[model samples]
Target: MKRVLCLTLALLSFIPAVLRAQEPAAPQEGLNTVMQKASYIIGRQFGADIKSNLPNVDVKALLEGINEAIEGKPSQLTEEQIQATRVELQKVMIAEQMKMAEADKKKGLDFLAENAKKPNVKTTKSGLQYIVEKEGTGAMPKETDDVVCHYKGELIDGTVFDSSYERGEPARFPVNGVIQGWQEALQLMKQGAKWKLFIPSELAYGERGNPAIPPNSVLVFDIELLEVLPPAANK
Candidate 1:
């Protein structure tokens, strides 16, 4: 379910294009057209999934609630409340997708565990699974540590999205400024140490696609920790 959720979230970015093309210009009436389109997509998708997953889900009432929330007249919910509801709806979608991702991940891991001589992967509490290669020995950096590092980041498909090593420049940043995966993993490495890290989507960017990375991406990084900047030098 976790694996499926991750994958589904990643795939949702692709859905907007298909849905937009099929959906005609929304009714130019009471509700804001843009909000109506967004609400329609979200409500319809959730309604369809609930019908399939939970037999008891009242799709009609659920949709009416969404529409009423969107309408925002006689204002039962404030503007902030309406926005919060939308965010909550999105989270529900993500949660359902995550459930599916977990199931798919288990199946994938099971197959690999059965077939491979030594499958190097472990699932974490947050439903993130990873394979660690070449454990490093040295002092790991804390979230506050300023560090110099060389890394090549890639998607599961071997597409090289970003690389400091390729650019011939070690990147510099405070460890906490990066994604949660990097925050956790870099803390495990020290100066002059190199490690290969396989990061799960939840630890990386679960649903949101950053500038280079797509949604639900499992990222691989060949990371070399060059130096941990001292306080004076960091300034």
Candidate 2:
């Protein structure tokens, strides 16, 4: 196979370099000394790569395969067997991920149900909830309008995922282009208003959450509507 030939040539290239290198008279050695160092370096690099990519590797089987390969023995598994093992692993990983998503969805629903009963919390028809911290007298932004706002987003457990306040700058975006929760809430918010929003996962990132957010996560945000930009300004 091409892969086997490539690997063989790579190993063979190291031999000539090791042979050409001069050694001290007292410690005259050949390719064996160089091979020991090369083996250690390769093993260390492979170990690091495996730990980073596959934390739950089978150490015994991995070592056995490496030993057998180094001893020039034929592979114990056929190509078909290797592909089948990989497919099975993928299936198991998917099953575990789905199980976790289901658990998270149930937890989110329970938390939202309890949170809906809190004083000052107002729920919209779309299941968005908010506590008006500071109501504004200015005009509210429409779906087509662009608005500037400062916000701090967090999970139900109070883990802060993002914050415009920390950066000392407000974010600007089209009202309709944001998550369903933001689009619904922004239309109800007037400029200079500050509100604490409790968003269900369905209204937030849904099942496939963003990088910092987990699947089926309940989100909280302290949002301040700074300015509602005119349609011309957006252009």
Candidate 3:
């Protein structure tokens, strides 16, 4: 009985290999097809982000190295080749990402610069600047205020991936507990103040973009300060 059980187990394992080998290669080709499609889609998006900044960049090589690393094939090449490739790939990715970030930063600064030339724009002491295109007299928050706010955040290209507003409730956090841009801009607002904020990548998510925002993405926020709790509110 034990011998029969062992044979059965061995055959079960071999059966799969035998079946896989005997099957037509069409299914494997199909899998490769899907993989290539997915890779191309992702690569294109990445290329767009990189291209906005890098005038002469080889996104394909960078992506191929990244893919190889992800696939655990770093040792596929000779050790020397692996080391060299890794170093070059790292430099390219970092440089490209940095370039993209700088471009986004410049875009934000450009917006500010152009707006500064217009009337009614104001600059605050904390380097928080604003051009109130439209003002809603809803209460705004004081500097020390802890507030509940709803925000819809998007890239300059209008790709919105985040919205506390869409979640059907406000995101409750301290006014001082967010990004530098939010910290600086929110303090300029009062309870119930609704503002359109253009945040430079530097002041926003910076070089390392968040999941919703790509590298070097300048963020736009439609923010509403809902409630400013009292100083002793948390206590």
Candidate 4:
């Protein structure tokens, strides 16, 4: 909430510059000057950010507040009142996010329960589940070893968030450098093994999901373990 206010202040600074340039402000007349057009573009960008973050904001109230602040007029709201309002709004937003995260966590647990019923799916004691698509004869990787693999990752809803195959290149990382689910599975998998992995939110990102993934989202990954090699220091 405070950051949004800061952004609002920064964007409004453009208005004074346009006023200094003697740019006319008449929406009915449309953008006729370069300064006006540029300011409109900046406003549109700010509008996009606000829409994505605070969809329920009152546009009229927002504009009025901005105008008051810019015109050096006394605001209907005192600074203390605005700060208190922001604190309350932040709490509401946090509560809403928690509800969404809990819902996602429940969906993931249900998916894992059904997935474990499949004949090929094996559930570990720690709750990791996977299906071995192809067996490998090579040795498995150690925690410190870096493994090269091709993998495609998706959410439970089949939203593909990442894929090494799409980039036409394999990815390499330490066995223990990944999420808990990947770390555990990689240690049990051998070079040349192909597996379909079902990772619950707890073993995946939990409530702090990646930018590409939603909070508490269950993950699905199709991985081909290509090679396992010691870390650079080992060589």
Listed in order, each prediction's TM-score against the native is 0.48, 0.73, 0.60, 0.81
lDDT of each: 0.68, 0.85, 0.68, 0.88
| Model 4 residue 213 CA deviation in Å | 3.2
A best-first ranking of the candidates according to their lDDT comes to 4, 2, 3, 1
lDDT of predicted model 2: 0.85
Clashes per prediction? 14, 0, 8, 0
Q: Compared with the true structure, what per-residue lDDT tens digits does model 2 show for residues 1-235?
A: 2333455476567656755763533433543455456656656656766665456889999899978986999999999999999899778867777888889889889988998999899999989999999999898999999999999999988899999989989999999889999999999999999999999999999999987998998899999999998788887
Q: What value of lDDT does candidate 3 attain over all alpha carbons?
A: 0.68
Q: What is the C-alpha RMSD, rounded to one decimal, of candidate 2? A: 6.8
Return whichever of 2 and 3 wins on TM-score.
2
lDDT comparison, 1 vs 3, better candidate: 3
Give the alpha carbon lDDT tens digit for every residue of 108-183 in model 1.
4454344334466554455444455555566678888888889899876679999997798999999988988888
Q: Candidate 4, residues 1-235: lDDT per residue as tens digits?
A: 5556777788778767766886465554577776758778877878888887888989999899768876999989878998999899989999988998899899999999999999999999989999999997887999999999999999988999999999999998888889999999999998999999999888998889988998999899999999998777457
* Winner of 1 and 3 under TM-score: 3
lDDT of 3 by residue, 46-122 (tens): 55655654457676776677678669875457989888976886798687678867777677677767755756657
Please provide the root mean square deviation of candidate 4 (C-alpha atoms, Å).
Answer: 3.2
Worst lDDT 10-window in candidate 1? 108-117
Best by the TM-score measure = 4
Q: In lDDT terms, how accurate is model 1?
A: 0.68
Best by lDDT: 4
Model 3 TM-score, all chains together = 0.60
Ranking by TM-score: 4, 2, 3, 1
